[model samples]
Target: MDVTSFWLAGRPATGDETFSVTNPYDGRVVGEVAVPTEAQVEEAVAAADAVRAQAAALPVHVRAEALAHVSRRLAERSEEIARLITAENGKPLLWARAEVNRAVSVFRFAAEEARRWSPTTQRLDTDPGGAGRLAYVSRVPKGPVLGIAPFNFPLNLTAHKVAPAIAVGAPIVVKPAPATPLSALVLGEILAETDLPAGMVSVLPVPNDRAPALVDDPRLPVVSFTGSVPVGWAIRERAPRKHVTLELGGNAAAVVLADADLDWAATRIGLFSNYQAGQSCIAVQRVYVDRGVYEAFVPKLVEAVGSLVTGDPWDGATQVGPLVSTDAAERVESWVNEAVAAGAKVLTGGTRDGAVYAPTVLADVPADAKVLREEVFGPVLVVQPVDGVDEAFAQVNDSSFGLQAGVFTRSLDVAFRAHRELNVGGVIIGDVPSYRADQMPYGGVKDSGVGREGLHSAMSDYTEEKVMVLTGIDL
Candidate 1:
């Protein structure tokens, strides 16, 4: 199956060569997609530009209505989209279906947010009592936006950026990851069916190297990117004028205290720690176990992690699926091996087959290792012993990446201290680091990302503030 031919507008551009989408489970070629060339990207951008004039001219109400129509259509076609996500991205079918639901919710919330957008009113005085003036702040559209979505949560992340831009009357050019472009392409089809008009929302599957051109293009007024930190920074430097919203990589930490319930903590951490094969941005990358419970926690945690069934995501019984690609799988494996070579003990699951690395757990991982310091982007966790809560908090705050962190604790003071000093944007009281809500402010501090994402916050990012002033009024 090939989706490159499914470009939303302009001529269908496919190379003589096709890029294969390999099933990470067995390295089988499940489908082939078109490799878009520079010319194709130009055409797609042109098409989006053609629609930009009309889309920007439309009343905000019209855009909201179009988005509402899209939301309804998406809900109706949720199952089909979910199946495509499963086939293309290799996530569990159940999780894929949940993601589709979340995508639709994002659209719905974005539409509501757009409908409620209004400028703030303020009083301004030009002179004391004699010459008075009134003023207010108005928000204007930021024009066309480019949404570069990653493979992990393709449909939802795309929706988070694209839906709001369209709702607020900005044309969007979406470039989905090559491995998981199917569902996003399907979303484009649904958006096309709405009154969105031609060129308003263009979905193109472009090669990785050619993506910079789309960001560098002067036509785009804003760019919302979700991917690695290096690429995000590169785009920031290259697209100097465009407004940027980046959700970059993170090395999330989860701290388990000495007094915490071992059974409950072990089960919940095991469940959430490996969700989506541990491919999520906020998934726990480092676990700082208090020395009091280190030995006791290791065996139970290892047993829980090892018991997980790693196989096809489509299979209902498969708790852990393959990583996104063989390269990613190998990267995770090599990191674990290096750690073990450096005297880190493998508590359980130090193995890999094709793109499926078993739910791996490591103890005594050094703070400098890539697996502990950087975003692993796989189903692996590193365990380290901390003297106490303060040392654990210090270790968690030691990294440059701080998206979210977690603490399994009973004391309110410890939880509050973790919240105050963990150096992360979010701190979960009794959960792992894999927590996120579409309605809350979501982003990281330091190098993790630039701005916040949730429904309202995203809307704010895509707009500009202009203060309208009035002078020379008789008192």
Candidate 2:
């Protein structure tokens, strides 16, 4: 019976029609959100357009101060925010708290980046013809941005969109995933307390049908989306004129080389592959092990996965919780069943109950199997043995999605080779692909994503560079 309203035009706005926000754990109604009509979506966009210049006109220090204030306020209510994330997204309480912490860091990074925002000055005297001239390359906001985020990691992902826009002084309209809009709405509530201009930030929880209004709108000059490939690409196609940054799905892989520390690889891989029910974009999905250490690594991986506690997300001891919905769990079960039918061996943990799927580990799965090739966005991991590092690298590169790949090797040469040869956005050394620092340049190659999403990278994406030249400058 908790009722949440959309943050629209600097205030809370509600509609007559409302939708139930259910807890994925026990199918209980946790809250209700007002669903906006298409007209309201248009109004929100116009409001954001009206204030784009106001946002851009704000001084850098003021924007930085505002972001810093939000960061401190979020820290004060970290527990409440964590519980909100757990309630809607089905993420474990520990993971939810970590997400909040990362969000706070994101804002802090934005605050720092905002204060340091400046143009690069290039001395034109490098060439004789360029004597007594100076060129300044500076970035400007790309008008209003349309941020479409996914249900997984709702708070941090929304922060990834909003913080950068705030850092660069661009107005942003966030369309959080309908299933988990409460977190974003709460963030909007906090933002309203800041000194930001009216309509600089708006969180609209509308149906998917009305999403086209936000995506295809001509006024919004930039679109930043993080979600599935099909939807992300469709948004790009529809908004062909806008500056689009798509962070899509990935079937991430990791290689365990012959020289790797088997215990280290086994323990890290097991924990990451099943973390948050494997809902993350870069969660370790496919692990390729060198045949020399396959036997020693498999048992340890199986044992690690088997030890995870799966149940209610509210439990402090629970490591794995239910997926976003029962349908998501069923899809994961069916994919595992399909893989098994194609001669795959289930090493351990392949079962589903309601929306809860046990952490599954598979071996010898066919390369064409859906579980191996596609983004099995569930708690499933596939283990394939290879004769050597070359074969393992090939297997990792064989996927259509290449967000990130991890190579565990003590040899510096092998690490360099993997770093150079892997067709992924990032190559992790001595760990799993699930490892991500909040401030790194994070995105994928191929279908994984289109642009980088670290604080600085995202600020760059939300801005456009212009060159200012002085023809008669004395040094």
Candidate 3:
């Protein structure tokens, strides 16, 4: 197997201890990555702090040009990065390619944001209380940012953290998930070629136990983490007083109204629930169908889901691949079995082989069941029937997560109702909650997360606003 080293302070850092990265399909070792020690994590933080000022002082145009370079370089190597993502994260090649494209878009968006960023000017004399003063609110870098990325969407999610920090001129230390560090390390390699300062970025693949060193360190003033809810909240509790943005877990739902087209809704529901093995935060885990159309929609959804091909991720024909590991597949199986024991019927697909779990569709699952209540993070979807749009909306809202929800309705009133009543960061009309534009503000509410994460939104999170007032100045 090939060996990869962590990218630290514009150079590769190798250590004696290493962890193996295996392909979830067939259990073959793809590569090995060196694990950083806690001391190394501290070193990375200090290194980032050393050049924080240089990164913060970089001119906006210079930062924009550098991000543009990174974007161009990424586009050139898209295929290579996509293959790496597939090998490590167990996502199909097609989806991996899409993720690469999204990562490139993220950098481009950040580049554009960097070039166009400007302070908001306010007239301080609105009420004649400050007659001759003008005030302006400017966003400044929040110093060293500790960015922790998850395994799923390894490239784009890391970009969501790293690209914005660079756009806003904040030095960052990224600790990618150990299972999928190669993609982020490859990104770090591309970024190392840019004109960013020496200590501006570091991609360290450290053990989970040692993550606290990076999280609770005093030198890093900002913490942006994308992962499970428990881990994210724990990090927030342990970290010092700093700007923290947590993009945590979600058990997202999609409501199918009686007025909706069942075929269209079923097609979208199947596509998203099985996409990338249903590892997305906003993947349609729970679907609430209006009882009038429940019988028709469920069968169509089962047929649509049954048609998906599950096999080797490298195969172009494969639509769904293995879960991240055999253990994850086992967990999904247990959850399905638990739901089954609790009186839920499997409409189709409740089987597993090695790391591969067939796309599952469950009907009549109780609200209190584990599969219905928790973030499965697998290719299992629960479809529940509701009386009407009101009941469907209520069922969708009955979750600890409020990341995003989808409502399939033709009526503007229903759409507006979902928009107003559904407790989520975003409500999608006529599509699955899985839909997300790379430039849109995306995050969660409640246990889902604490902050938003698009190019502009993340730039805002990585920066702090300061108001400057000139006294006795002509307006």
Q: Write the per-residue lDDT of candidate 3 for residues 225-265, one digit (tens) a residue.
A: 99999999998888748888999988889999999989999
Task: Rate residue 338 of model 2 by lDDT.
Answer: 92
Cα-lDDT of candidate 2: 0.91
Give residue 226's lDDT in candidate 2 (0 to 100).
95
Ranking of candidates on lDDT, top first:
2, 3, 1
Per-residue CA lDDT of model 1 for 228-329, tens digit only, reads 999999999998888999999887888999988887778767766687888998987788899999889878888888888778887877778888888888
Against the hidden true structure, what lDDT does model 3 obtain? 0.91
lDDT score, residue 418, model 2? 90
Tens digits of per-residue lDDT for model 2, 1-475: 7578898866888877899888999888888999777677778899999998889889998899989988998899999999999999998998999999999999999999999998899999999999999999999998999999899999999999999999999989999998999899989999999999888888999887788878878889999999999998898888888899999998889899888898889889998998889999988999999888898899999999999988899998899999999999999999999999999999998899999999999998987899998999999999988999889999899988889999999989998999899999999999999988977889998888799999999999999998999988898
RMSD of each: 2.5, 1.1, 1.2
> Worst 10-residue stretch by lDDT in candidate 3?
35-44
lDDT minimum window of 10 residues, candidate 2: 35-44
